[model samples]
Target: MPEKEITRISKFLSLVLRHQPEKINITLDENGWTDVATLIQQVNKSGSRLSFEILDFVVANNNKKRFAFNPDKTKIRAHQGHSVEIKLGYPPQTPPAVLYHGTSEKNLASILAEGIQKRNRHQVHLSPDKSTALTVGQRHGKPVILQVDAAAMHAAGLVFYLSENQVWLTGLVHAEFLHVLTT
Candidate 1:
């Protein structure tokens, strides 16, 4: 596949699967899976061409590993980062001792005062490593990394989930659990 085609389809898939299934006239089940056949047909109807082969390629090759297929490959769902209301139903897990969050420096003041909020996303995303967090932050501009004391947060009873893609998911990270990671 041409790089352009793959990139286009990957982005479109991310958009629909994570944020707007309605854009393609499909709805995800409560657990976020959508029938693969139906999703492909819907994509075609929406003026985009999709096939199981292409879908498989995107799921396997996406840098973030953002989508997943069911065991039989009959269904699919975004690994996380859903803004649309849907229960991913990922079971809670104990997070690592530390996690990292990346954001633009412009948001530092609010984050320092109030802590990180999910904003429009369903949950605040944390990376297991600083390098991944840095990449995420760079998207927003002058990257700022926040080191999260995950062990402390877990001890304090904050729940955490590990997405299939390995991102950490939590409702919030209070300022007390956060430290600005200085280079």
Candidate 2:
């Protein structure tokens, strides 16, 4: 795909699935999912009309498995962030400590690699307590937390911890840790 087209799709996915839609001033649904009609309207309002074909093509070609057509294929939802449904897709033997998310913005299958090991997008080294975890999730959109192997994250050098009232950092785990703890 052309670089511009790729960037457009990336932005589309970001706004649709990621909570960072505010970065572009596009407000998504409370659940962060917007129907196809609504999305088309948004596009039209932007002085760009995205046809159904283009929308389907973009959704199909998106790397992240963030967007999904509803069961009836009528509405679409960005299945990003926290999901109440328990994805027992992982093996029962696996311990809970680190959760994996697809950083891909192209293929959704890459986001779900059953059985095989995976990596996290931002290895958030949060306090190992529920209250703290919930507190850390505050101010930001509520994030889903699947049990992950904390030991693996620590071993792979992808763990970052935030102080009691701070949780803003974007870099390698070490830099993020310093920034969060120091600030």
TM-score of each candidate structure, all chains considered together: 0.96, 0.41
lDDT of 1: 0.92
Alpha-carbon runs more than 4 Å astray in model 2: 1-3, 20-30, 81-148, 151-183
On the 0 to 100 scale, the lDDT of residue 73 in model 2 is 56
Off by over 4 Å in 1: none
Top TM-score prediction, candidate number: 1
Write the residue-wise lDDT of candidate 2 on 1-183 in tens digits.
Answer: 555785586566555445454433455555444566666666676676577777677667764434666566556655433222212121212223543221222222332333212234322333344444444344345433233344564566643343212321112322221111111
Q: Model 1, residue 3: displacement in angstroms?
A: 3.8
> lDDT per prediction?
0.92, 0.42
As a whole number from 0 to 100, the lDDT of residue 102 in candidate 1 is 95
Model 2 lDDT, full chain set = 0.42
